[model samples]
Target: MNNRRLPSLTPEQCGSRILDAKCIVAFTGAGISTAAGIPDFRGPNGLYTTGKYNADKVFEIDYFHKHPEMFYEFSRDFIQILKKIQPTITHRFLARLESEDLLTGVITQNIDTLHHRAGSINIAEVHGSYWSASCLSCNQFIKNGATLDWWEEQMTQSPRSPVVLCPHCGGIIKPDVVFFGEPVRDLDKAETMIKSCDLLLVLGSSLTVYPAALLPQLTSASTIVVNQGDVMISFRQDMYFILSDLDAFFKKVIDFIDS
Candidate 1:
């Protein structure tokens, strides 16, 4: 998976570069979670390309406000899939990198909470996550919102799948995930992490979605982009792209690190 526009690096080379760097930050997206049964937006079998899961309705803020049920139906399935899956090898690799102090933190575009599940402590969930929900009508009035277990139980209750509601106000409950129209959650912290890091690993992201996409461009750090398919970002002298499977590629990196 070499791109004609720029030179590509092997997983071992990537590993060597990572080990040489003092500060490292990883930017992840749905591609990293696809191995854990979550679908990415641009992949052939992804949510947007597949006939299932209407991208426009599932993520659009205005559509959710008008017909929240559509989003709920999508969520019902998403949560069900999420409950049965485990974090992928790529997820564990990042977690291990952080635990060993070789990596700074993870800045993720995924709302799946896989990074947290993998035991990465310092994570900036740029897209927000399903792990927390707020009362839409009350405008996050509940200081401590319902736990994830509560949210799951409510979202999956039988008879007819219902939109999760805020227990306090009986208003619709919205997962903290940033919708298409909403601003992403943690740009400031993600920027700080990226700007200060000596190396940036762009994993499983298309780099098409702004301003998360824009974050990588802001830093002059050595950047590596790894994804199976085509990405939007162009190649630069300090930047490298490895067009390969996320888990397979990371497996080599981790193996090299141990050796």
Candidate 2:
């Protein structure tokens, strides 16, 4: 839902701003991971449209409590998808910016952890990630380092066994990801970063989600949105919108910066 009466910017202009900025923060969403074979939430091939996966039951807390299997089934496929993909060009561009000290940090709604894998040091996962999980019964914690092995063991442990369960109390293991009715993770920190940055880069997000969507309003930082479609918010000043393929846009941006 875009109201296109606001001012627009070219890739070179946006790159010039980025090169001049002291602190550049990136805000990303599922669109960043779509090229990595991860489906967008409302996109055509997203979980909502797929007959095999029900978005309501997969993310709804009440539904999860009653039928956790539905979520685990989705998770199993999601984890497999992650295995087959690497970070996209956009992901690498942000990571390279971070490495060159041009980027302050990243604030992301994606749970893929692609930013982390791409070598971004500072990040805020507004929606929690699958990197870590905890036991619901005994509050037993599973560290990120152990997550993959643990997930693998459970999947092959038995055919009738639960997809994910606590080894200690046989309790269900819940990933740190935000479910429906759950508050976003690290909101306070994310807001602080957003407010402090000199530039806010919106990448691959529809900006339809609440609380997280309100972040841009909390800052007067120059905003640059690079995605394929419309974004919900339209700023009056210091804003730029580039509606194009993320990778192609970023390639142009990188060229502008290096030149």
Please give the CA lDDT of all the candidate structures.
0.83, 0.81
* Clash-forming residue pairs, model 1: none
Flag regions of model 1 displaced more than 4 Å. 1-4, 40-55, 141-148, 156-161
The local distance difference test score of model 1 is 0.83
Worst 10 residues of 1 by lDDT: 141-150
| Best candidate (score: TM-score) | 2
Summarize candidate 1's per-residue lDDT along 43-108 as a digit string, tens digits. 686556776767867989998998888788777667766778899999999898899898999999
Candidate 1's clash total is 0
lDDT of 2 by residue, 12-64 (tens): 98888988999899999888887777766567876667778787678887888
TM-score of each: 0.86, 0.89
When summed lDDT is taken over every stretch of 10 residues in candidate 2, the lowest stretch is 142-151
193 in model 2: Cα distance from truth in Å? 0.6
